[model samples]
Target: MNVKQEHLKETNPEHEILDILKNRWSPRAFSDKKITEKEVKILLEAGRWAPSAFNVQPWRIIWGIKGTETYDRLYNCLDEFNQSWADNAQVLMAGAFKKTKEGDKENFHALHDLGLFMANVYTQAHSMGIATHQMAGIDFKKAQKEFKIPEDFHVATGIALGYYGGDASVLPEDLQEKENKQKRERKPQSEFAFNGNFQNKN
Candidate 1:
């Protein structure tokens, strides 16, 4: 099932915000289709353009695609269950951040900047007709050691990206059941954001 971007594009993008937003949900289910290296390079390039503190560009993308050393190294770092669903993904991307540029500055602002990079990864991929999923369910410390990441680099998260498969074979049965759960139920904006100061109500 080659799920191209056109089949996934929900809205006409002609003043239809809901159409786009409504279709933008993370899917753990990914197809076995091969994503081109060109697309991978372009997506990472988008991430490279993310805003960083003092132009340090602290983000690094360590990736494993199908049959490479990276595949084994990253798979071994996952926490069992994640390796189940994520293993089927076309690409396993590790988002790493540099603690400091030139090994100086008490506050390197890597975490803050890495966040901006991840945003670019998902949104840009979406616009390009690609689907991506960011995963936090991995042993970060183990990944750092396995990937030969330097002392200055911190493994922030793992991301599984590619086309999404539509069957339960691509995901665990329990997770598939939750696939269509409403976004509002996941996190209401009121709980995550406030009007001004600390307000108890949403």
Candidate 2:
């Protein structure tokens, strides 16, 4: 599948936004093309600049490119559902965050900061013609143990990174339907963007 053909699924945003943002969507199908080390570093750099509470910068990523022992370890941390398709990705990553502040106090905002870090990585990858899928379907405890993560940190998500547009036929029948989806949908601003007090759109 050609990369250009994948753009047909770009979202129809109600308001103008960056083309990269509009075009970005998580795909279960990934091209096997390898991502260069330099490109990986660039994506990490983008995450490194994300703002954090008191600049604690709690986010951390343990990543490995395909065909490496590290990659296999990361892949094993994913749940069975993710492993079904994520094996085709060129790179895999474990996203983690430090749970404590300097005094061992809880950093309630750690997960939020990690999300910001990922948003930067996602935008950067999209600009580079790369596609990324972030998954919560991972064995966090397994990832923590496999990576020998310290007690202060916790694994939160797994990430698959690769080029867009792969052979959907390689996926299971149900997943192939998702891989070939032509439209992207999102909640309207009114549903979640309240002008003042919160209102339950549901």
Candidate 3:
């Protein structure tokens, strides 16, 4: 089925924005098409170049494409709820941060830096007609051990990537309705972007 994503776009923004930003939205269903190794590298390279405090470059991603052993291992690390939907994704990733690559001192900003890295990955992938859905619902400890992540690093998130797939019928009735009709919602800039006093603007 040809799924229409234009309807999924956010309604009129307060201001204009890039198509990449406008088009980026996560969906539970994914096509079985495999992402090429070169395309995978592009996603990683975008994340690798994201800015970090003192240039620590703390983000780390362990990924595997569908039908590979690595992919199986990564998928097993997801919680049951995520596995139900993410199984259709062509690529799965374990995202982590090296807590202190520079020295023994803790890098307080490592998690925040990972967010920047993920944003870059999302943008780059969208540009290539790939969709990525980041998930907080993961078996972090399982991923850490399965991926052999070192003690210095902390597992943070998981990602499922692939070409878009699924129709509302593909999901359970409860989710199908949501899948077919949910609109993207976000707090207004005034609610979070403060000017001086950090209070909600009218």
Candidate 4:
């Protein structure tokens, strides 16, 4: 049971947006095809140009291709649920951030900056016809220990990358349903975007 990227693409939007932004989505299913090192480097280059507070550019990434020791170690850091589906990913990455500035002062915006970096990476990957799924279920401490990450850095999230379209039947039944879902939903702008002062839509 092969799935096509078009089958999962979001066809409608409340307002017009770029095709890439409109079409990009995170999918649990990934193809067995391998992504080349050059392509990975290009994705990182996109992230490298993302804006950061005070130009701190605090984002750091530890990535590995499948079948490597580093990939196995990174996979071990994922929670059982993520490991179940992410095992099919051709590439895995741990996204981290520097928690402190040069003088040891806390960089309060580090996490936000990291998000920006990942946004760049995600959009770039989409443009290149690659699919990406970001996962929050990971053992941060385990990743730090396994990668020998510095004390000043914090592991934030994990990422799975591969070519778009895959065998959705390989996923667990529940996730298979999700992978096959065609409609992409999100909160309307009215719920989050403010007119004047901030208003809690919740």
lDDT of 2 at 118: 98
lDDT of 4 at 45: 100
- Candidate 4 TM-score to native: 0.95
Q: lDDT value for candidate 2?
A: 0.90
Q: What residue runs in model 1 are displaced by over 4 Å at the alpha carbon? A: 1-22, 180-186, 200-202
In the range 1-202, model 2's lDDT, one tens digit per residue, is: 2247535485789999977777888887777778998999999999999999999999989999999999999999999999899999999999999999998999999999999999999999988878999999999998888889998999999999998877888888879988887888999999999879999998
In angstroms, the error of model 3 at 55 is 0.9
* Candidate closer to the true structure by lDDT (higher is better), 1 or 4: 4
What TM-score against the true fold does each predicted structure earn? 0.82, 0.96, 0.91, 0.95
**Candidate 3 wrong stretches, greater than 4 Å:** 1-10, 200-202
**RMSD (Å) of each candidate, 1 decimal:** 3.9, 1.9, 2.8, 2.5
> Considering TM-score, which of the candidate structures 3 and 4 is the better prediction for this target?
4
Alpha carbon RMSD to native, model 1: 3.9
Whole-model alpha-carbon lDDT for candidate 3: 0.82
* Tens-place lDDT digits, model 4, residues 1-202: 1235564565688989887788888988887889888989999999999999999899999999999988899999999999989999989999999999889999999999999999999999988878889999999999999999999999999999988878899899989988888888988899999989999898
- How many clashes show up per model? 0, 0, 0, 0
Ranking by TM-score: 2, 4, 3, 1
Task: Give the higher-lDDT candidate: 1 or 3.
Answer: 3
